[model samples]
Target: MSPELNAPGISEEDKARLTQSGIELSMQNRCGSYLQMNQDVLHAECQEEGIEVLSYRKAMEKYDWLKEYEWKAVPKDKDEITQYVASQTDPKGYVIIAHKGTKNILPIQACLYLGRETIQHVHNIIIAEEGAELHIISGCTSGGHVGQGAAHYGVSEFYIKKNAKISFTMIHTWTENIEVFPRSASIVEENGVFLSNYVCMQPVKKIQMYPTATLKGENSVARFSSIIIASPSSYLDIGSRAILEGKGASAELVTRAITKGGTIISRGQIIGKTAGTKGHLECKGLILKDGTIYAIPEIDGRVVGTELSHEAAVGKLAQEEIEYLMSRGLSEDEATATIIRGFLDVKIAGLPEALQKQIDATIDVAEKAGF
Candidate 1:
């Protein structure tokens, strides 16, 4: 376990930094030098837990993390972005799954590092064998605050085999000026389950992204969840997609948008392409001050043998509900906070225990400020 793992209230990002520092300390004390990128390096520390570490330069070759892979894949190399992407073509972020001859019960962990303030673009490819289970956590943040135009684009793709289980959690809270485009996808096989959670707590100016997970196997399942808070002058366009292509496949999405003087565009979709698939999309928005909040939700089914459901709701705090709370002698802010908490209680309940508590605290703060 990394040092930050034991620290209370520390974020997934801080834990990643500690893990990176620990790896460096181990290499220097045991191997005599810090690990460097762009060099083809592989290690077999343990057969049960296969581990690999690829430097930022090595992860950019196949996966362009600095720019939107499918959304904005053309080219924008003004600030050494192109050079950084070129460096990682040799060996993308290291890969370690079970050997063909052996099967393991432990999930492999990958620790990615951003040792500089320059814009980083990283691409990663992970494959889990039949019946394998892996929990991969990717962390992105700058080592220090540099000048403007310092950004990072991270794109990853995963392939989970039949009966495999994979849980990927990406937490981002970088400098206020940095821009990030994080794109990811997973293809699941029969009886496989994939869970993806995208949590944004930072206040950024401009962001555009919509990560997706497609369930293409029978009895496969996928869940897409997000938590977003928009402040004054900030703009964010974020959403998720779940597509079911086989019988007995299922998908569900839930999103929450909190806006105040800023604009947020949320688009969620559930598409069923074949018979016997089940899918649903739910979008709920909270307009604190009503700068501008647009909620566009779509559910499309091309086959008649499937069940697809979708819902879009936009509104302010309920007047009657607020009045009822205020009648108990609480102030207006307190009443608004009470209603907002009740609105988001169920959503927070489903989050990971650690993250749920953090979100609850944030909601408490938001309520005090008339959120």
Candidate 2:
């Protein structure tokens, strides 16, 4: 176990909460880690040779060139959430940089813990230099004692250089009283690849986010996948967008949403702006108990040679499917859970096995709860 995990302030209950959010406190099989409690950065370190992990403020002070990348992908004046995070004179977040040609067999872990702050805000930047490969797992949660009406605002920007690749997986476990707003964007250079996966099965008061990516170099690629469940008191509005601007560039956006007496709005968009570029968007939703699941998918092709397509479906589980499972000696609840599990199972191509297992474990929790 890392000494930081056993640090004085973190309690057993808090550790359990972090674990549910996909945080590995032991630091086993992790190449780097960053932890922030409320608005304070508790720890940030890198174990790999060619990677750099530091607090946002420390990164800015260490590298002057970092200023050019800050807010370059995500505009500060784009929305109120971005403005709030941008106005913070003393920002709180972690910056991870993978140097040229570097790769980590194990993924980095980032944790954001909301404790007592009414509003916790952060600005994060990630950069993958040419020929580098970076993988990160981010866990966001709240302390057991956090009160209602707490909110979190975050802004993240990613830069993938030529021939580089970056995979980021994020898991959220917040209390039903907390609200979250995240503004994020990314830019992919020539031959670069970017993969983003998000999972949030826990209850939250309200959450809204729409992340965008721009593929700017020839043969660049971007893929985004999200799995979410909205509980009775939760209201989730999530979406993702991709713009293919380079010749031969491609993008894919996929989402799986489930509502258990809550409200969920799943959105996706893809724009093909260059010749030979291609894009696709897909969204599938399921309503369990009189909840709302709304899906919005959009695809735009600007040029004659560009191609774009979208598909969205929102409905309940098929009774015949559930009955078919029950005939195999399973109970009604078990059959329903099995079908829901299969519905939420979306195998993402090119994702690391370790990250895939982490995502599976998150969904397994919801399945065990009979979702």
Candidate 3:
């Protein structure tokens, strides 16, 4: 086994205990092995015919100390893998760091399984060493679990080193009576780049979030892209931000939101500092029904030599495009679905092969429910 597999944190006994207990869902470490994720144990049974036990905590401890990090999926049970790193944290909870390696290879993925009557707080941290590259994928769904009292609070923090690159892709969905609070932020160093892709599927409750990235180094860059859909009683207050400093730094913010059954508010900002810096913010929203969607894209330039720009558009799906698709053998709903799928494809297409297929299947499931 690789040294990364023997690190310490979760125990082997716990892994075995959780394996024989509950519905064994899919949980994979950087080693790419599936295991059960019960709250009672920190590790899980290996899927390769019991070849090895998967330890969540120990998996996280495998990476370099300079790259300390954490990861956790929502609807976390008591035996979930989380650590109490701080005391004054709001929405008191634990954080699970899946990997913090000096070299970023495979993308990290987390799937949140929620049912009726579930409430949870999940926090994650990602650290990319100088010149490292990393990609993180997250999917939130409530497919098999259902009842009531289902709520979740998710928080994420990331730190990128000089010349590093990090990308985050998040997909959110929930049934009726579900509420979510997702808070995230990242810090970028000189010559580093941070890119975020936010995809929101059918959500019936309220989801308020703002994923921000701060460019504190010279020539650092940030980009934010979003695809949001809100239906009956759904609310989304989400956006992105970037702050640039030093010479030749830059930032870009872009988003696409659609409201049908309820309301959505998008707020985005990009700020520039000192000479040789630039910033841009863009937002576009599509309203499919009588619901409302407010757009706010702000750009601030603090230096005389810096450039700042922003653009926003809010409207329904273009009738011409819809009609054109309908004329091409697609029904009204199909036409709308096609467009929505295309909007999301640009982002999901860049994910890892395994993850890309999963995201595509997720969209297919959502479209079958009328999106």
Total residue pair clashes for candidate 3: 15
lDDT of 1 at 221: 85
Put down candidate 3 lDDT per residue, 1-371, tens digits, no spaces.
12122212324543222222211223433323222121222233222221222333444445455233433211233222223322214423222232233433445544444444656555555556677666555656553345457776666677777887777667666665777777677888888877787777675588877777878888887877777788877887888878777578887777777787688899998877778888888787777788888998888877689899888888767889999999999998889889876765645323455445545665676677776
Each model's C-alpha lDDT? 0.59, 0.91, 0.61
TM-score of each: 0.71, 0.98, 0.73
Q: Candidate 2: RMSD over Cα atoms? A: 1.2
Tens-digit lDDT track for model 1 on 1-371? 22111233335664444342222223222211112221222321232433333343443443464233322322224234334554554434443343222333332333333444455565555556687665544434443343467666655666667887666555554545666665557788888777776555455666677777778889888887776767775688888887898689998888777777678889898888889999888878888786777888888889889898888787887899889888999887778877767766645222344334434554554455555
Put the candidates in TM-score order, highest first.
2, 3, 1
Candidate scoring better on lDDT of 1 and 3: 3
Off by over 4 Å in 1: 1-117, 142-147, 346-371
- The order by descending lDDT is 2, 3, 1
Q: What's the C-alpha lDDT at position 109 in model 2?
A: 92
| Model 2 whole-model lDDT (C-alpha atoms) | 0.91
Model 3 ranges with Cα > 4 A deviation: 1-102, 115-118, 143-148, 343-345, 348-361
